[model samples]
Target: MRKKAVRNQLWVPIIAMTLLIAGCGTKTEPMVDTAAGSKQQQSASPAPAPQTPVETVELTISAAASLTDALKEIQTVYQTKATSTKLNFNFGASGALQQQIEQGAPADLFLSAATKNMKTLVDNQLIDAGKQKNLLTNELVVVVPVDSKVSIGSEADLSKPEVLHVAIGIPESVPAGSYAKEALTYGKLWDSLQSRMVQGKDVRQVLQYIETGNADAGFVYKTDALTSNKVKIAFAVDPKSYQAVEYPIGIVKSTKHGKEAEDFYNYLQSKEALDVFVKFGFTVPK
Candidate 1:
């Protein structure tokens, strides 16, 4: 009986140990599965998305100095509407700008005060011929200092001995000067006014000369004369006396911003831009 009791005790401890091992093994498997599920959930989560980039472009425009006032206002309106594109303007004599473009200057668009300058670019195929158009027209006039007593009533007065110095733009380059030459030649005053002439680089310079009293009288675009408070219109040249003064604009052929340049170019021909030009004393061409 003692041996049997001892054997029974041994069997009881063995069975209890086996039950404990089985419980621990089952719990461990569930714990491992739970940890694996958490890892799987973490691996299935999506990453953040990338952001979209903004579109932006810059265009450089070479325009005539005469268009300065109107363009300044137009630029403000354009920026308000076209927030992605920026306009950079280069204002100067149309002839000079043409030379710069011919020399490979980085210009996207060209606005000339006269068709002759535009022709130079077209002849060389520097501008997109199809995109070229006459945009505006202007009148030529004689002006004098506000305080001057000179009786410069007409184009003929420019020849009078009393008018010691008459300012005119250089005929070889300036459109205003070319107009002045045409009018003087047509009126039979070119030869007579030679000794009394003070040639200027551009129309604005002629206006300046008259305003500062450096010249007794000067010939300039009506628009340019209007900009100075110190100068007054003496007379308006008859339209028939000179070739029609037309302003033309075109896209430069080498421009990289073709779409943006075309957009701005078309915008300049819009009614809103035309209104601004007219307000600044420019006559929109038909």
Candidate 2:
């Protein structure tokens, strides 16, 4: 009886230990699973805060007719770098462009062919005067149709009898016209050529007249003359005869893309854009 009781006690302890081991073993996987689940929930439910969407800005630029090509080329480079920006350009006579801006056209940038127009904007506080920079300079040239046999050697050649029709931008509004008048007056031919002159609203219109053979000769920027393969350059007027054609660029005061606009204005003075302007017959302004 004593032996049997001792044997029974040993088996009781063994059975209790076995039950404890089994209980621990059965809970191990569930504990691990619960820990893993908690980690997953923490990772999956990160934060309720919303992320900001990338912004897109539209910048409107009112520029002189002469900068149409250069601006277009520059826009390509700008767009490639600033993928979220959209550049829209309105090219016209400097005076007209100023009028548009003054009349509440949504312009982020203003580029004038002459300082006179830029001054008009500055006087009205439409642009940030402090940000304005003189970017380029240009010279006036006389252009005739490629097939025209009109012999033109100098400003003196403009007064010939065969040069019946001459196209010029309206002197009051167009910077090119202002430059043309300055050249003609300095050469003492303004009065003589007045009778044969056809006035266009803008310099581009004058170019159109010559390109369509509507005029025997026309006065335009050297850059414009270089742009057309059909028009032959008769002569480049002496820079001394005309007021310097300096192009000034500035950011509009009310621009929505204020930061981006200034960035692009800075880019204009970059070597990449400057080299392109030089290739198209424009000189860097001093």
Candidate 3:
């Protein structure tokens, strides 16, 4: 009976340890599986990538019609350096463009063919005075049709009674016309040729009249005369006869892209752009 009691005590202890180990093994298996699942979930998830910013800038430039070729060339050069920027150009008579700026058009830059139109903006405080700079110079010339026989030896030829329908830009609205008026006054033909004047909106328009043979003769800039193959250059007006026809550029006070506008303005003075200007028949500022 004592031996049986001893065996019963040993069996009870062994069974209790076996059941406890089994419970621990079951709990540890579930914990190991849960830890592995958490690691897999963390490894499978993806983090967000950083984003890149998009840069864009638009610059609007209002310039004279005569500058069409030169400015377009400059624009091509400018855009090459700053591919993210867009250039917008408004070409017309200086007086007309000045009026548009004065009316609060969104203009980042102003390039005028004449100082008079620039002065209009300066007087009104529409342009930054410190940012203004003279950029180019030009000379006026007389143009006639290729086959015309109007023997225009001097200013006196324009005063002949038969010289009817002489084309000139409207003196009040065009710089070329104002220069022509000064030339006429200095040559003593302003009064005699006043009645026969056929006024045009701009020098380019006056050139058109002569090219179409609708007018006997017209006054335009040497640069303007070079643009057309149909019109023959008769004579270049004396540069000393009138005030210097200087082209000026300035940053508008209302510019949203003032820094970029100034960048482009500085580029105009660079040698690369000046070469283009020279190729187009404009005298670059020294």
Candidate 4:
């Protein structure tokens, strides 16, 4: 009886231990790592900030035809500095240019060969008179074909019989022509040569006439005369005969890119641009 009781106790203890081991072996859910899970959730990408786009502004400059060569050089140098702005030039007679601006042409600035054109715009309120600057001075000269037989010493030489087609810019619109007329009138040679005159649209056109031999003699700015190898300056008209040939530049009142236009305006008046002007045979005023 004692051995049987001992065997029954041993069997009960062994069965209880086996059941505990099996319960441990049964499937169960693993503990969750809350800290690691929160870290993963926070590591998700954050919303990005909105960025403003930089825009390139195009500034339109209405300049006199005589300024072409200098401004072209200036354009090259300016692009290096103002990478954000693009320059667009509209070159013509100063009077014609101001008239266009008055009629709402798409111009940001007006660079006139003479002050009269600028005055028209100022009186009309298209440009602020106070903002204008007398940027340059020029001399009117008589030019002839490099290979011409004409002997021009002064305004009197233009009246010679061989000088048939004397080209001058249209006096009403072209500042160069106005200066020429004023100079010739002062010399008392205008009335006598009116029949032989071939009026051009601008000083450049007059230069072209002389270059192509369409005109025997023509009046042009000294700067224009230097641009062509086909024409030679005959003589410089007396500066005292006419109002000082001054170039005035001003910002248009209706510019959409006001800030950019002002920047370019300030650049033109800088030493770098003035150097280019001097290189092109233009005299920059102090």
Report every candidate's CA lDDT. 0.90, 0.90, 0.87, 0.92
Which window of ten consecutive residues has the lowest lDDT sum in model 4?
A: 40-49
Where is model 1 poorest over a 10-residue stretch in terms of lDDT?
25-34
- TM-scores of the models, in the order given: 0.81, 0.82, 0.81, 0.83
lDDT tens per residue, model 4, 88-124: 9999999898889988889999999999999889999
> Model 3: per-residue lDDT, tens digit, 1-286?
9999998999998999999989888843343687888889888996667888768899999988888877887888788898888999998889999999999998999989899888889889999788888989988888889888878866678876666888988888789999999999998889888788999987889989999988989998888888899898888888889889899999999998878988888888888988887787889766
> Which model scores highest in lDDT?
4
**What TM-score does candidate 2 reach?**
0.82
**lDDT of model 2, residue 90:** 91
Looking at model 2, report the run of 10 residues with the lowest lDDT sum: 25-34
How many residue pairs clash in all the candidates, one count each? Answer: 0, 0, 0, 0
Q: Give the TM-score of candidate 4.
A: 0.83
lDDT of 2 by residue, 193-283 (tens): 8899999888888998999999999999999998888898998989999889999999989888789999889999999999989988899
Shift in Å, residue 248, candidate 3: 0.6
Candidate 3 vs. true structure, TM-score:
0.81
User: Of the candidates numbered 2 and 3, which has the greater lDDT value?
Assistant: 2
Runs in model 2 deviating more than 4 A are 1-52
**Top TM-score model:** 4
- Under the 3 Å rule for N, CA and C atoms, how many clashes does model 1 have? 0
lDDT of 1 by residue, 22-127 (tens): 9888844334688888889888996678988768898999998888888999999999999999999998788889999999999999999899999989999998
